[model samples]
Target: MTSTFHVRGGRPLKGEITVRGAKNLVSKAMVAALLGEEPSLLRSVPDIRDVAIVTELLKVHGVKVDRDVATGLIRMDPSNVERAHAAEIDAHAGSSRIPILFCGPLLHRLGEAIIPDLGGCRIGDRPINYHLDVLREFGAHVDKRELGIHITAPNGLKGTKIHLEYPSVGATEQVLLTAVRAEGVTELTNAAVEPEIEDLIAVLQKMGALITLQTDRTITIEGVERLGGYEHVAIPDRIEAASWACAALVTKGDVFVQGAQQKPMSTFLNVFRRIGGGLDITDDGIRFFHPGEPLRSIAMETDVHPGFMTDWQQPLVVALTQAEGISIVHETVYENRLGFTSALNDMGARIQVYRECLGGSSCRFGWRNFNHSAVISGPKALHGADITVPDLRGGFSYLIAALGAEGISSIHGIDLIDRGYESFREKLTALGAEYWED
Candidate 1:
């Protein structure tokens, strides 16, 4: 069944919503459970499609997964993990890129692993070569087959040094999961230091993995003989928190996001403040609201951790439409993320995407023809239109546009949002958002 959201516009959203464990972190932590010799308990797990996908994948591998939806708790036992059939694995994987992550753990536990063609949101050209190359570096033999790419560690997995061309988070995760149980010490340079990555490291540490993060983007992991279970609470979802913050600004509303943290979101909070949004940081959570003053335009660039995130670019772009003057956004992380702006333009947002890199320093896509930079000319009045959700982040941004538009918007492909945000429809209702699902 296809899911659609019919949203009525021109009303401000106001109220409180809670964010749970990060969609980015929880799925990976689920994969981490495969390395544990015993059962592991995870708390603050969100009710999202990705988590469900991981749970199913684990079950297929003979891992016992006990889940409590109400408390957002998951107990995963990988003590009996075994090889699953290729077709079954492929069927369970569906369009998720998660299966790629199973390679290391499966290889370590069963001496072989098979990963089918991976799929994810159409946000960028995220290649799997980084993952495959890291696996090969660790003595895994990769073979191309009709069923999927089969990997085997004949000589047993051994650790090695790896340096990433870019600080890719997924590839870093692939290395951490594989390296924690390899035969020797592993060192990774130019690794991604996202808070989610750190949280995963914490999970591994709890499982008896010795990992260290240096001042530089280098991470060192010492392979251990055995790993035990861990009970861990994941970090809050900063992307979702920032999304709601942008929603509050776009709709001229106030939203108190419980479970939102201040440290991981420091960069986003600075950007939100620079755009003239109000933020009240506390020990518990952060409160975001419009200051009733005209929103200001600012030049921003998306980068890795400790910088403005690419996921924040979309929703913030929708809010930028209501800002006075021109706001420049340079999406350096994803080469094609700005493609979603066309839908916003259709809703009367004056956003122009350009191939040439704009705002601060030139990036990896500086010379590419892809439209990676966006110039938003705003304070433009928006009218609702028929909208199609593009990707996860873009889909949420479309909802914000619909809520702020003047008329009703029929939004299709809203199920994409379920891949990330948890209880979004209920949260929208709590925030006084006028919407219905069909």
Candidate 2:
């Protein structure tokens, strides 16, 4: 069951918290370990629900998974991989989409994979059809069963060309993991080039996959007959790093986010600076603080990689609640991302959701029934309220709202936050946040 957090607000969180591996990549990286013939070592793995879920799923399939939580080092062995029953797989799948991606690796080893239906954050419509489509292009026969998805490659998987209608990260990953082992050459047009995808590519390359990156978001992979293992360190969680930074801005606090990188966060930092957030960045990490003055509001848009991330939208929106003047946010990635603003409005943030496009170029959601844009008129004094956490990113955003509000806030479903943030309660305590779990 999910727990509740009672937070006494209006406290400036101080001190430091370290960010570990990217939650987005680490789980998939563990899945990639199944493609290897020998043991693979992944370092800087975070202690999170996704990792734990993926670990248990892999273990159910007879993959030997071992980890040192203190050091964030994980060693995965796929030498004796076996097929897990649907019930076994479904029990471990618990609220993670990683199970679908496992079909590619499992079809290669066991010739068939029964994956439970997908489930995760309810941010928007994230259909698994894209993954299914990519797998079909690679010669895998899929049968939709009552309980789960059944996939097989009776003739053995073979590579083929594919063009995505949308450059989805999960679909691109499905192509990469499957293509690396299929026969002949595979070329994917309009593939997602997120930093996490790049990191996964690096891991696959370390396992003897021949892959090529083109200038125009095209990836070509030459299937190899056999593959070995790899030892590598994962990139830090850019999303988490930016979240803590947003917390600092919202609560008028100071925080040193260790292990936060600069390259992946350049776009977010630029926007953060324009919004009147103070920062002292270094080779080690970034120290985010309040400007000690009024925070300025600005117009921003969430986009694909090398642009502002959609995941960074919620927490930063809470920070925007403290800024003077109106802030416009155009969420081009997810159609319903602005839905979290309802709770913030209850806490005194004046955010309005719109069905029409605002602040940026037109997107796929425009001219539709979906409310994909938002306008926040801020410098509003936030008061505490009873709220339930929604999704991973949105849950953390609620904590930021609670910390900036006056009086006590009763927040439930905080365990959802553990799906991404590692040891957040301890980190909150270290930062002097007056909160207790019940």
lDDT of 1 at 240: 98
What C-alpha lDDT does candidate 1 achieve relative to the native structure?
0.93
Q: For every model shown, what is its TM-score relative to the native structure?
A: 0.99, 0.99
Q: Which ten residues in a row have the lowest lDDT in candidate 2?
A: 89-98
Superposed model 1: Cα runs more than 4 Å off: none
Runs in model 2 lying further than 4 Å from the true structure: none
RMSD of each: 0.8, 0.8
Considering only N, C-alpha and C atoms within 3 Å, which residue pairs clash in candidate 2? Answer: none
Q: What TM-score does candidate 1 get on C-alpha atoms?
A: 0.99
